[model samples]
Target: MPTILTFGDSNTHGTQPMRSRSSDLPRHARRWPVILGEELGWDVVEEGLPGRTFAFPDAEMGPHMDGRIGLFIALESHGPIDALTLMLGTNDLKAQFGASPGEIAQAAGFHLDVALSDEMQDRHGGFEPFLILPPKPFAAGCLAEIYEGAAEKAQAVQDAIRAQADARDVAVFDANSVVSVSDIDGVHLDTSSHETLGRAVAEFIVAEIVEA
Candidate 1:
């Protein structure tokens, strides 16, 4: 089976926005990655870390929160992938980080370079990469307080990603087009949204990668 590796944040980790962090994690069946695998009959490897940032490291969230470092590790662990998907940048909008959408996009481009490095290409035997612009954040409630103007920032990030994808000739998918953030947290995905996103991503992969 062709293997696809996904690197992302809490949403990709199948976080249940309505559930407390102390509660049991969402079941594998609820995660989009698993759903995508079942839909495509492809091997899906999910590497999602909560609070992950493309370039910045969150001391409060621990060393592993740095997506740059995490991506390297994940690449080594899940090498020889047939395709890869990246979804990140939301955490970079944290009040403390103060990163603009452009900055986040630059970081994302850097990560894309790393994933497309000679070593990675050799491992994967050369495969196309997908850059997914995560769904826009809600403008109300707790997430609003945490990521002020998140919706606008997400839009800017999406534009940057589109430009980058066009320049690099990489496949791009807009998560916002297929899914919406949960109203409960205004950040994470609900189970239904996960299903929607999984089906959408599966379709994109079939057209962009499998058929191509």
Candidate 2:
């Protein structure tokens, strides 16, 4: 079976709607990454962290939020992966970060560049880099205050990221076409969204990447 490294942020970490506790190891059969493995019968390594950002080091959230470190770790830690999937950047919209969608998208492209690097690809025999654009979050629920004005910025992420992914000639998928973020917290996902989004991503990969 082929293996895939799904490196992403909280949503990929299976964060449930309405944040209140710390994120633990992978769970939820309905979680998209879990569903991804089930639907495709492929080995899926889930690497997700709360508050992870592709652009900046968060002050309040801690320096660990720098996603580049985690991306390198995940690539080095896993072996013989056929693909690496990146789904992140929403956290960059934090009111504090003040990052524009274009900057966040560019930062995300950095990961694609890393995965496609000759050294990293050779380490795994070879691998394809895939980008999954995160669904835009609505500013509401407990996170409303922290994510103030995020929704407007979220509106432009898809196009911005698409432009970057296109420049790299990487495969990209828009998660919003299939599922939306949970209305509960706007930052996390509901079980139903996971089930739907997971299946959607699985189908996209199988049709576009695996069988293409």
* Candidate 1, lDDT over the whole model: 0.82
lDDT of 2 by residue, 1-212 (tens): 99988988888988877654444534555788999899989999989887899968889878989998888888999888998789998898889988877788888788888999999989999998889989888788778887899988786877888888899888888998988887778888888989898898888888777465
Point out where model 2 deviates above 4 Å. Answer: 19-29
TM-scores for all candidates: the values are 0.92, 0.93
Candidate 1 lDDT by residue in tens digits, 1-212? 88889899988888777434355665446789988899989888998888898989886788788899998899888767888989987788777787877888888888888877898898779866898888877545545677676766777877886787677778888998888987776788888999999999999988985567
For TM-score, the strongest prediction is 2
Q: State each model's CA lDDT, in order.
A: 0.82, 0.85
- lDDT of candidate model 2 versus the reference: 0.85
